[model samples]
Target: MSETRTRVADHIKHSPGVHFNELVRALDLAPGQVQHHVRRLLSDETVRRAEFYGRTHYFPPEFDAWERGTLALVRRETARDILGHLLEHGDARPDDVADDIGVARSTLEWHLDHLVERDVVRKERDLHNRVTLVLTHPERTTRLLDDVSPSLPERFVDRFDRLLDHLVEG
Candidate 1:
């Protein structure tokens, strides 16, 4: 795929509900140019768009190993950090999570919010007024990872291993 299409695909995979304007901003492409490529991507079925907040939001199609596919579109380094932290202890505060992931608080919050919005993770408020994170279903964690953006069933484990290594090395 062209770099632009890959960027669009990755953006949609990570932020399933992202709009054209946001895509334009994210990719630093003009609105018309972004729209053109997005339309092509949609036609190819490599990406999809959905209605959200009264505008069109893009996403990847449901496939076998969705989570790994979805993570591929995300900032891999950021995702590596976030997933590593979650898989280790299952949850943490947004602040601690930021530290764990080596991201700014706002960036971590962005990723967390996106994850929560996608139902890939759950959020809770604790007694100390701190935000707590948890994977909604432990049993489905593997499945969730598998289904995030769709991948071949055989590649799930291998991809996950690489994802882990990506995080660890970061």
Candidate 2:
């Protein structure tokens, strides 16, 4: 493999769920250059791609479906914040998570849906049927969060979601 491809592979191996834009920024490579190398890497099976929540995240071949999904979701700041909050608080109500994370309830629900769907989070109901959010795999999620960092696009998406929530709520 070329030096650039090796660098890209090593990055994905270390980072696991890094998106394209994040890879470009972290490696300080041009977008087109990264895209080119990524394509070659994919063709060569040096890295695998997982698409979730409108972002294409690259991972090493060793990551399973659950790891890929969890890593991908945690790449979004709000989702990571939610996971971290749940990890710290044990189990929490939807409103509490939204308030603690400073995101609108709608935004939190959107992320929660993804998390729940992927089995990363579990949503239960109380006697009154009030919703409670809990991390289904807190330790694993926390460990993966250490390896998965948000990309620039993921950050922008999170900000845009918050902005939309503000505008809608207002």
Candidate 3:
């Protein structure tokens, strides 16, 4: 691989769940340049990708489907906060989780939809049908938690979502 291609590969290797725009920005490369290198990397199987919602996250070849999904969500600040809260506190009521995370219920629900769909989190119901959010793989999720740090754009997007939720709620 060329130096540029290697750099892209290394970035994706180190940052398992980095999305496209973030990758371009992080590497200080033009979008076209990044796209060309990424295409080469994908063709050679040096790295892999997962598309979650509207974003396409790149990963090294080692991460399985579950880890790919989990990492994709983990790259989002709100979703990461939710997972971190649950990881530290165990399963709890959805309302309590929203309150504890200081996010609107709708925001929490939005992140929860992705988390639950990814199987990184599960919602359990008691006999009364009350819901509790539980991590599907506590130990693994805890380890993967350190694998990603949300970038400025990623954080901004998540915060924007929260702001919109607040607007709608009010």
Candidate 4:
């Protein structure tokens, strides 16, 4: 592998679930340059890609489906905050989680939907029909959180993507 491809692979190895733009910004490389190197790395099987929640995330070849899915969701700040809040509090009502994370209810619901779909979170209703959110795999999610901390720019991109998704869906 070329030095550039190796560097790109190394970055993805350390920062699992990093998206293309994040890679460009973090490596301070031109977008086209990063794309070229990333393509080469992918062809060489030095990394793998996962598409979830409207983002194409790259991971090291060793990551399993669960890890890839978890890492992809946690790379977004809102989702990570929700997971952290749930882990800290065990289980919480939707309103409580929205309040604790300081996000609007709709935004909270958006992230919650992704989490629930990934099976990292579970939603249960009491007899009274109140919804409660629980972290289905707290220990695993916590461990993966250590590996997928998004930078400020990545967080901005994630929020922007969510906003676009909301507007389009509406």
Best by TM-score: 3
What is the TM-score (0 to 1) of candidate 2?
Answer: 0.86
lDDT of 3 by residue, 1-170 (tens): 79999999999999998889888988999999999999999998998988888889899999999999998888788988898899888898999889898899989998899899889999999999999999999999987889988888778988988998889996
lDDT of 1 by residue, 1-170 (tens): 88887887887776654566667877888898888888899898988666532556566786334343344333234554576578787777777877765555655665667677756677888788777888665555554444343224324643565456557656
How well does candidate 1 score on lDDT at residue 8?
Answer: 77
Winner by lDDT between candidate 4 and candidate 3: 3
Root-mean-square deviation of each candidate, in angstroms?
A: 10.6, 2.1, 1.2, 3.6
**Highest lDDT model number:** 3
TM-score of 4: 0.85
- The lDDT of each candidate is 0.62, 0.89, 0.90, 0.86
Candidate 2 per-residue lDDT, tens place, 48-120, comes to 9999868798999988999999988887899999998998999999999889889888888889989999999
For candidate 2, which ten residues in a row score worst on lDDT? Answer: 148-157
Write the number of the candidate with greater lDDT, choosing between 2 and 3: 3
In angstroms, give how far residue 129 of model 1 lies from its true place: 2.2
lDDT of 2 at 21: 76
Candidate 4 wrong stretches, greater than 4 Å = 157-170
Off by over 4 Å in 3: none
Model 2 gets an lDDT of 0.89
